[model samples]
Target: MVAPRKYPLELRERAVRMYRTSDPRPQIKRLAVDLGVHPEALRGWIRQAEADRGERDDRLATAEKEELAQLRREVKELRRANEILRTASAFFAGQLDPTRPR
Candidate 1:
């Protein structure tokens, strides 16, 4: 069995671009044959990359929406707590200074 060779990322990106372009099938096949790799392998790489790009975009949008929701809840709770504290402070102040109250 032949040992599999490691390919660089730039090479893979180039291969994917070539596979995705409007080149004729025969030309693509000849390029793959010259590179000693299957034409289908390059085509599959392009397809998988496209799928992954869309999936990543969707996940990023979902995460941002979740984070925004959590932040809004936090702001609401904090405002409620602050209002309660202010009300209590006013009540105590009135009770302590009723003699010369303004």
Candidate 2:
């Protein structure tokens, strides 16, 4: 039986990088075959990475706080924009009202 890898992260990443380059398919296939893992698993890893490309944090408890922090920053920016818009709207409304004396 093969020794289970507690940390395949680095090696798996290298293998994925090799696969993406102009490296031959046979070489990639042979690497996976020698690793005793299905080729599709490598593809799945790459796909998952691509899917999470833009997502800074994942759906984990620790990441949740990071996500919340990011969301709070975004909300603060939005609130500022809304306040600016409201100010502009009020100024325009006051200027446009015909019944109010200039």
Candidate 3:
């Protein structure tokens, strides 16, 4: 399940738009203060917005990150199931060996 966002989408979008349009491109820290958001958080939001708009390509977009996370989880679950099957096979093989001690 996705966690609830601490800040609303509207606010994030507004912050990014303001940052982009501001004269001289105001510093992240100062803009964050004006917007009542954490500087680092605002910076990350701006970066993500830019990436989504194709203004930046250095980082993964939100959808890509979510997809990557989902794929990673599926891989982890498959690995765990594979390990369980291997152990079960080993145990069953041992049980079927007639020469093995009871």
Q: Please name the candidate that would achieve the greatest TM-score relative to the true structure.
A: 3
RMSD of each candidate?
12.4, 12.0, 2.2
Q: Which model, 1 or 2, shows the larger TM-score?
A: 1
Decoy 3 TM-score against native: 0.80
Better of 2 and 3 by lDDT: 3
* lDDT of the candidates, in the order given: 0.69, 0.68, 0.93
* Model 3 misplaced regions, further than 4 Å: 1-4
Q: For candidate 1, which ten residues in a row score worst on lDDT?
A: 55-64
How close to the true structure is residue 14 of candidate 1, measured as C-alpha lDDT? 78
TM-score order of candidates, best first? 3, 1, 2
Model 2 lDDT tens row, 1-64: 5588643778677766766664455454576777666777776655555445543344334445
Ranking by lDDT: 3, 1, 2
What is residue 48's positional error in candidate 1, in angstroms? Answer: 18
Locate the minimum summed-lDDT window of 10 residues in model 2.
54-63
After superposition, the stretches of candidate 2 with alpha carbons farther than 4 Å from their true spots are: 1-60
Summed backbone clashes in each candidate are 0, 0, 0
